[model samples]
Target: MTMKAKYQSVLDLGESLNIQNGSVTEENGVLKVKGTANTPYEKNILWDKIKEIGGESPSDILANITVADESVYHRHTVKSGETLGKIAKHYYGNAAKYQDIFKANSDILKNPDLIHPDQELIIPNL
Candidate 1:
């Protein structure tokens, strides 16, 4: 497959993430991609997808993904029935990290167990 076609999913994901200043090109046998992700989490996910398809340290692709926001890992919008533990698990892979999330959002979150839909929480860098 052509290099561009091989990494099409990564391009689709970048589009879905609304990556800014995105560009994709294939030169010789290598694919080149450049974009700015809104948050570190988005950039990380893009890299993860690239690795998943190309293997760790694959030489087939070169991606230049930048993060627009580095203050926090990500900004999560709470949904119905979502708890701090669930949110923490999704971001940090550990439900026990809920306390960290709670602390980062302490200004708006009076209690860790009391989050409502539409509330934006900062998924702090751990």
Candidate 2:
């Protein structure tokens, strides 16, 4: 499929990417510990069960989660032979969202089928 055609039917599986933990593992001291149990209790003992398994702070772990790109308000330069439907799929991942793209770029895109190369168009994330 052409790049523009491929972009005309865009979609993303909202899956979170897993990042391997950056914890050290090795033999240390007399016992040669492989990994730390890291039990931080409220009173000298680790209480958060979630941390014991994940070994990362909530915010730090959440930061690694993959998220779809969302545009608030923006502009896009039309490449050769591109259509608003294609642009809609490129940004919103659904050709049905072409109306959204048209509404967003109405200032420049007077016709849904009329787009010119190198022309600037507005893009609004919905």
Candidate 3:
């Protein structure tokens, strides 16, 4: 199969995710994909899909996935019933690290327990 056909799923994923500056090219049976994902979570989704289709270590595909915002590890849009501790646990695997998230987003978050839906919080780098 041609490289284009082999990696069509990945290319489609880029489109679905609205990846910025995405480009795909095939040469000598190798596929090259480049794009910037809005968040680390988005980038991880792409990698997961690629690995799902191309195997754990596929040599035929080369992907250059970059996170658009490198300053913060990720940005989380608050949802109802979510707390800083829950968000911290999701990102850092430690509920005690909620203080880190609270400090990072002190401008908007007055209290670590008062996050409301639609509020965006910066998950600073560890």
Candidate 4:
């Protein structure tokens, strides 16, 4: 198996990630995630999801994946020729952080082998 896939599968065994569980009921323009508390993670994660899926129909990304506890992760658009090591050095200032990125964004990035342009990834600071 690839490194990214291995890391992601490992994380799946640890904790469950949160997503919009068809919990939001709207009449006109009101939207809300039912049975949820308001916290820093609530705001940041919501905004992040919206931004990543901008100007389009409902893709339901957060709905299908695990929800993280803290929203310390930042988003990165994959550029051609970009590698996990490069992303690690750019964000965490250490090459070792690539593994964290790989772990955080395994949904779309199933391996550290190669990332494509225009693909968005979540790079966790922690």
lDDT tens string, model 4, 1-126? 432232332223222433333243333332323332223334445444444443234332222233443465556788989899998897667987888888888888778877899988887757
Which is the better candidate, 2 or 4, if ranked by TM-score?
4
**Candidate 3 C-alpha lDDT tens digits along 1-126:** 797787788788889989999988887788899999987877887998889988999898999999997788788999999999999999888999999999999999787778899998999888
Q: In model 1, what is the error at residue 100, expressed in angstroms?
A: 1.0
Considering every candidate listed, which one attains the maximal lDDT? Answer: 1
**What ranking of all candidate models by lDDT puts the best one first?**
1, 3, 4, 2
Which of candidates 2 and 4 reaches a greater lDDT? 4
TM-score, prediction 4: 0.43
TM-score of each: 0.97, 0.42, 0.78, 0.43
Measured over all alpha carbons after superposition, the RMSD of each candidate to the real structure, in angstroms, is 0.7, 17.0, 2.5, 14.4
Candidate 1 lDDT, tens digit per residue, 1-126? 999899999999999999999999889899999999999999999999999999999899999999999999999999999999999899889999999999999999998889999999999998
Give lDDT tens digits, candidate 2, residues 16-120.
111122122222211110112211111111212224433554321222121223333346689997888888777667888888878877776687888899987
- Clashes (candidate 3): 0
| Whole-model lDDT per candidate | 0.95, 0.44, 0.88, 0.54
TM-score of 1: 0.97
When 1 and 4 are scored with lDDT, the better candidate is 1
* CA deviation > 4 Å runs, candidate 2: 1-73
